[model samples]
Each structure stands twice: as structure tokens, then as C-alpha cells.
Target: MHKNLSRWREGEQAGRRYAFTAPSPTRYPWQWYWDSCFIAIVRSRWDRERARRELESLLAVAEDGFIGHIAFWGRPLDLERAVRYNVVRRRDLTTRTIQPPLLAYAWRIAVGDPAAEPGIAAHHRWLGGHRDLDGDGLLWLLQPDESGLDASPKFDHVWGPRAQGRRRFPLLIRRNRALGFDLRRVADAGGPVVCEVLTNVAWSLSRQACGEPSTTPALVARLWDERTGRFVDEARGAVHRPLPPERVPFTWDTLAPLALPDLPEEIGRRLVEETLLSERFWPGVPLPSVALDDPAHTSRDHYWGLRRYWRGPSWANAAWLAWQGVRRLGYRAEADDMARRLGETVVREGLREYYEARTGAGMGARDFGWTALALEMLSPRAGSGSGSA
Candidate 1:
């Protein structure tokens, strides 16, 4: 279904060999952390060897235990764009921040090469050591982009108003750059830091996959809001002088914990019956980054002028994540329906960066890579979740 994925493939060799899928050839040439994980998962369907190499390429760029959100492989980079976007150090050509630690999850589901386990463990360790600011078992995000739901309304409070956040975004970039992307400096200087729900959900899954002790799932359970019946994001600050990450918006991010197999009975039930089945999330598109009823939810990604994304669009990766979670929770019928809707949507509209929340129409970048994740949903399964709608 995602045949264009092959067209988005690229490689790097200043001296070493590296190959990975680009989110988009023209728009996003750099390899991203979670994007590669999603790409690797789907890549395994058609080509197992390439999937392995794609992850290997991603790991080759990890510096110490930390893996940057974006890996600017190949020394020849657009220095201006690199600096403007995110580059902790020009020499490393990787961001100082991290994405959801989905490497182990991807490896197990896609390749499971025993050799890659060490790198996976180190990446997980790096996160636990550096990103977990207050021993809350949840990792804190230094920048909004680190959440992979950049520009999501959940973070609008960080930079004042959502619209003003655009102008102030560069200021945040400059501030992080000034500190050389040091965790201690960034956390202490924190105007706003977050313990994002989606990120911790991914971390808990990956950490458990790597056999690391998981205090995150328990902490994530604590984020549940009795009033909303949704788990909210935390806002923990610097390790030097730490404070718990406060509650933020209760967006679709609240549903991420459902992916866990051991999700609490009541929490998972409310998420499915109240949120997923309701009009707010399932109006037309199976799900949106933000809930449909949310005031911040808009049809268009106005926040991003040209590359607008993640505000309210229905992303394939997000759907895939949700599908995996719901299915694991024994909601087989509902999970299959989600896969059917997303698979059908992608078929009707071409693979794009994001889709319209209500119509499932394509939006953002063209020939997107991770949207290829739909292949898994469309694949043959042994049970009721087997076929697409």
C-alpha cells in the first residue's frame, strides 16, 4: 500500500555505512527517531534486511546513551536549517533531545536481532539516567518537539498562546542552543517542561521490552484524572531543583496508556466507552491528535505556515499505536474497526504527513514514510482483527 516508501529511502557514508527511510525526501531528509521506528516496522513486511539496516543506521548515530530526535546523517548538512531546527552540536549533527524510546519495541516487532539489544539497552539507560528528572518513573520532555506531537495544543501553554508559540519557538531553540543542550541547564532554565503522556506510554512499552525496570507504567497510572477520565501529561522540571510536572490538556494523548497490556480495568473501559466511541474522537476520522470537541481542535494546521502538522490531524502512526493498544486490551472488535477505517482512509487518499481529522483527507507532506505503518493493519491476522474494513 505504501509503495512510495521505497522512493523515500536514502543512505549516508562520510566513512561508515548507513541506510534509512526519510520521512519525506524533499521536506524531511534527516532520519528521525520514531519515524524510523515506524518505518522499520512496516519495512519488515516487504523487506526484512532493509528494516534491520534502517534501525542499525538509526542506532549508529546515537551519542553516548542519548539518541537525538533527528539524526542529520552525512556530514554535508544545510547548516542554516540544522541550526534553526535543532542541532545541539554541529560536530555531532544530532539533536540533544529525545523521542519516545520506541527502539526496543520496534526491534522486537520488526527485527529482534539479538546483536542490537546492547544498543537498545544503552539508549534506554541514557533516557532513564538523563531524561527522568525527578525519579517519577516518567521522563520529562525539554522541548515540545521532543514529544513528537509538536504544535499539539497540549503544549500551547508553554509559550503563552498557541499562535504566539510559533514566534517564540525559535527563541526556545536559541535558548537550548545557548546551553549546548545540557539537560541540567535546560531543566533548571525551564520556563516549561512536560512529562508528556504519549512519550511515557512509549517509554514504558520500550523499557519493558528491553527488560528494564518499569516504574513508568505505575506513574502513568497516577496521571489518571477522575474528573475527565483521561490521563494527563506531567510537567516535571530540572533534576538540580526539581518539581513535579503539572497536569496539562487532556487531549488524545490521554488514550496512549491504553496500549499497555496491563492497563487498569476502569481506566481502559472509560477511554474506550467514553472517549473512543464518542463523537469527540471518532467524528469521522478514527482519531485526531486533539479531541474533536476541544476548542483548540481545528480542521487546518494554521499554527504551521507551510509544514503545519500534529495539531489536529489523524496520523497513521497515532492510529497504529492506538490500534495496538486497544487490541491488546481485548477490545478486538473496536480495534479491528479502527484499523479498517485507517486502512480505508489511506487507500482513498494517498500517503501524506497527516490527514484531515473529519474526512481522512491527506494533509501536510507528500509521500510520507511512516504512514506505511498501515501495512500492518492491512495484513492478515489469525483472528477477528484480521481484515480491513
Candidate 2:
């Protein structure tokens, strides 16, 4: 625990432009939207002021309630030259698309309920106005990065080479405009138009926490696959179709709706009994990003040889969210056991970006922020509340 705390303190960065926690100093050197939220939630356990500042720095740069997925700290020209996707590049050293809306949940946890109100309202308004691309009451995820599950198989068909081109780029821009954005969208759109489960669940959890009406019903109607008894990624265009069990495997992201405390009993039961506790996801470590039986599962090697960035890696943040859901649904022993195993793995392997599902081998960036943050979740002082779904 002392080692983890020391690593976290070392990752803290304060600059003229931003004061926040970077997920990893060597790997991720910028302020990421959802990462900061998780960091702040954990930081609240020991340092309230730093926790508040972690979120406030991100909110300080929000435009019309849309916080960039990542805020770069250096000069604009240097960033502009390096960033290939125009959609993510901004004049003020930030990305354009927002990450999962976990800020509201984080703010309520780190700051007080009253202090979180304005940002919550503004962010909710912005999402409703600019992200509900098809007027389906649920928001659309433009890219896999926006959903925070970058290389999941759910988006495999959507982001393939065939989806890229000049024609699709303009349609994407038009779609953004129709959805209420004033700026021009510059990236080519070939990725699937998904009403991502995590994004919607996060939004719903945040709304409910803020005393706003829940959007779970709308989300269920859009993504719930009655045939599979799970939430599958629903594509907007006819470019994709539902796959058979042998070909397309269920991923942890599909079960993200379980994180919602108010999830319907029947749906939640199916998730816990039929999936999470089953051999599919509960193999050994608890919650892997991809199920072991899934055809797309890859336990060795990281994405692009950099690090295991979410593909078949077990993440503490995701596991902690699942633990909260399990505890909320009365699986006290199961949740506690899972939490204990996670803490043990982190302690043994040291703080890392993620871990190998079965072996618990530490992977990715070392001295990671969220890896250290997981210790706080395991501590007795941690509150029983929903974090990033």
C-alpha cells in the first residue's frame, strides 16, 4: 500500500495550464478525462483538495460542457504536427471527442453534491444536445477511444479498413452538425455507429446520482439483444450484423450494464448468474476485458506492441466497477473476494496499467495512477457508490 501511494504521488503533475494526475508519466503524459475521474475518486480518500483540483483542472477547459478526451500540455503547433486525426486535434491542446461521462460521478464523490451540480447539468445538456446522433434518447459513440474500450471486438467490424474513405468523412461531419456541433468534423468515418453500453451506463448512473431522470429504459431498448440475453453493440447502419456465438464472442464491455445499481432485477440476475459468475468471465482473475473463451481473446502481447491497452487485460478500474455492482446486488461475499484478489494481484505485481487475466502478470505502463487508485477501492473507507461504468 505504501509503494502504491508513493507511485501515485510521483505521477501527480502540476503545470501552468493544468493541475491533475496522469495515468502514467512514461506512457500517458496528458490529462485524460475519465482517468482523472478515477484518480480523483481514489484521491478523495486521502487528499480532498488534490482530488477536487484533479477534476477542476479538466472542467476548467470544457467547452459547452464537452470536455476533451485528453488535454495535451505543450505548445499547439507541436501537437498539431503530431496529431493525424483532425477530429481529435484542437487549437488549445486538446482532443475534440469526450470520453465516458464519469466526471459527474467523480465530482459528486470527490467534491460535494452541491459543488458538482453545475458541471453535471452542463455536461448532461451538452451530451443531449450534441451526442444523440439519431435522436434515440441515447448518445452515440463516434470512436472506440471515446468509449474507453479502444480495441474491443464489439467495434472490430466498424473500424475496419473498408469503413474509411473521403465520402464517409463528409457524412460524419454532417452527422456531427445535425447532432448540434458547430465545428467541422475532419476525420473519415468508417467505425460502427454504436450506442455504447459503457457510455450510456455512465451517463445514466451520473444522472441518477444527480437527482435527474434515468435513461436506462431508452438504453435497454437500443442495445439489449433479446436473443443472447446480453447487451450487444448495436450498429447504426446496415454495414454490420449480429454474429453467431462461435464467431463473435461476448466481451466484458457487453456486461457493463451490470454496474448500474438500479438495473432491473431480471436483467441483472441474468448478467450475474449466466455470465459474470460463469466460466466465460470469472475464469480466475475475476473480470477480464475479454472472456477467456472468446475467439478474439489475446492474453499475450500488448496492442501495437506498446502495452496491453485493454485487449484481454484485467483492469482494476473495470473490476472495481463490477465489484460495486455485485455488492449492490447482494453478492457480498463474491464482491469482497474479488476485491481481495485484485488487491493481492496489484500488490504482488506492482502498479501497472493492466494485468494478464489468468497469470496476473503486470502489463503496460508501470507506476500507473488507476492501478494505485485500486488500493483505495479495496480499503474499508471506500464508499459504496457507482464509479465509471
Q: Each prediction's Cα lDDT score? A: 0.72, 0.68
Which digits, one per residue and each the tens of the lDDT, describe model 2 over residues 194-297? 67888898888777767777788888887787778877766554344546533555778767787787778788878888888999888657569888887877
Measured against the true structure, the TM-scores of the candidates, in listed sequence, are 0.89, 0.84
Instruction: Give the lDDT of residue 386 in candidate 2.
Output: 36
After superposition, the stretches of candidate 2 with alpha carbons farther than 4 Å from their true spots are 2-17, 74-81, 84-91, 114-116, 162-191, 238-247, 303-308, 380-389
What is the clash tally of candidate 1? 5
Model number with the top lDDT: 1
**TM-score, candidate number 1:** 0.89
As for candidate 2, its clashing pairs are: 163-190
Instruction: Kindly provide the TM-score of model 2 when superposed on the true structure, using C-alpha atoms.
Output: 0.84
